[model samples]
Target: MCPRCRGEALLWARVPYGWTNREGGRVEGRSGVVLCPACDARAPGAAALITWFHVHGRADDEDEEFVRLLVRWATGVSVPPLDEHAPEAENERWQRGDL
Candidate 1:
C-alpha cells in the first residue's frame, strides 16, 4: 500500500539527522529541513529538484512538487495540482483512507 516500506525507511533513516528544534543547527539556507542521514539517502531526489528549480527559477515549485510526490507515495492516489484559493480534496481523502 505504501510503496513497500518507503515510509519506514524514510523515518528510520531520517530520525538520526533530525534536530529536535530548529534553533541550534548550522543554518544552511535550505527550506526543507531533514536529518543528515535521510538527506544522504534521498540526496539524488533532492538534488534533482534543486536543479529543476535552478532552471525554472521558481523555488516554491520544487517544494510543491515534492509534497505532491509524497502524498502520492503515501496514499497511492494522484493528487491534482494545488491552487491557492482552494482546499486540496486529495489530502482529505488520504486522511480518511479513501485512496
Candidate 2:
C-alpha cells in the first residue's frame, strides 16, 4: 500500500539527472521515488518532476485528455497551436448552394 494514497499498484522509479557546468564539470545523480497511479500522489523526489506520465501511464480513464492537460500545466509543456485555416469543404459546399 502506498503511504500517500493507500494505492496498491504503486510504481517506483529511479530518475536520473545529468548536467554540465560552463567549466565542463559534469554532475549526475539518481533519485528513488514512488507514485500512486490511483490518486495522483507522488513521493518527495517525484515532486521535482511532472510525474503524471508515470502515474497515469497505465490508466484507461475516459478523462485522460484532461489529465494530459493538467500534466502540461504542471510540466510547463505548452499545448500545440491550432491551425488557422477556413473550412474549405464547407465553403465550397456553400458556394455551390449545396447547403
Candidate 3:
C-alpha cells in the first residue's frame, strides 16, 4: 500500500496491461508494473508469481500468512515457498455445485 494513501492489496486478473489507466494518463510511480486498484500504487510483481495465482485462482485468499507473504512478493521481496498451503487448500474452491 502507498504510505501517502492507505491503498488496498495488489489485485491481479487476466487484464490487459497498459501504460496508463485511460487516455494515456500519467501515473506517479517508479519501477513497478503492478498497480493497486484503490490508489493506483505501483508495485513490482513477478510474472512467475502472477502465473501461479492465475493457475491456482488465489487459493490462499483467507490465509493470513499467505497474504502477508503475498504482499512481500508484490513488493519485489523474496519470500519462502508456500509449502504449508498445498494443492488441497484449493480443492474446496474448485468444486462446483453440480450435486
Candidate 4:
C-alpha cells in the first residue's frame, strides 16, 4: 500500500536522470520511483524519499526507517514495513481486505 494515497497497487520503477552534453552524450543515474495506480500519483528520484517522509513520517526516527523499508521493497530484498504502528501481520490483513 502506498503511504500517500493508500493505493493497493503501488508500482516501483527505476527512471533515469542526469546530464546530457550538447553532442548528445549522456550520463545517467537511476531514480527511485513509486507510482500509485489508484491515484495516478508518481514519486520519482531522490524527491520520492523526500515526499514520502514529508507525507508519511511521524517523527525524525521514522525517516530512516521508511527509507530502509522502501529500499528493501524496491530491491525485492524484503517486504516494506507497513504503518509503523501496525504489526507485520497488517500486510497480510491488508491483502485479506481485513485492514
The residue pairs in collision within model 4 are none
Regions of candidate 1 where Cα sits further than 4 Å from its true position? 1-42, 61-66, 69-99
Task: Assess every candidate by TM-score.
Answer: 0.22, 0.27, 0.25, 0.26
lDDT of each: 0.37, 0.49, 0.46, 0.52
* Model 3 residue 40 CA deviation in Å: 14
**Candidate 3 per-residue lDDT over residues 1-99, each given as its tens digit:** 534355643454232222444566844433333334444323354444444555765547687755654666555632233343556556655665322
Candidate 2 C-alpha lDDT tens digits along 1-99? 656567674445454555666688976756544454554434333343335455555533367664554443334322233233457877888999998
Pick the lDDT winner. Answer: 4
Better of 2 and 4 by TM-score: 2
Candidate 3 has what TM-score?
0.25
Q: Rank the candidates by lDDT, best first.
A: 4, 2, 3, 1
Per-residue lDDT over 1-99 for candidate 1, one digit per residue giving the tens place of the 0 to 100 score: 123433322221111122223455542221222212233334434444434434654334247775553333333222233243345777788789987
What's the lDDT of the predicted structure labeled candidate 2? 0.49
Worst 10 residues of 3 by lDDT: 12-21
User: What global local distance difference test value does model 1 have?
Assistant: 0.37
> In model 2, which regions exceed 4 Å deviation?
1-9, 19-24, 38-99
Error (Å) of candidate 2 at residue 96 is 83
Highest TM-score model number: 2
lDDT of 4 by residue, 1-99 (tens): 656577664445574455666687875667655545444333323345445645774324356766664564455322232243577677789999997
- Given candidate 1, what's the lDDT at residue 46? 44
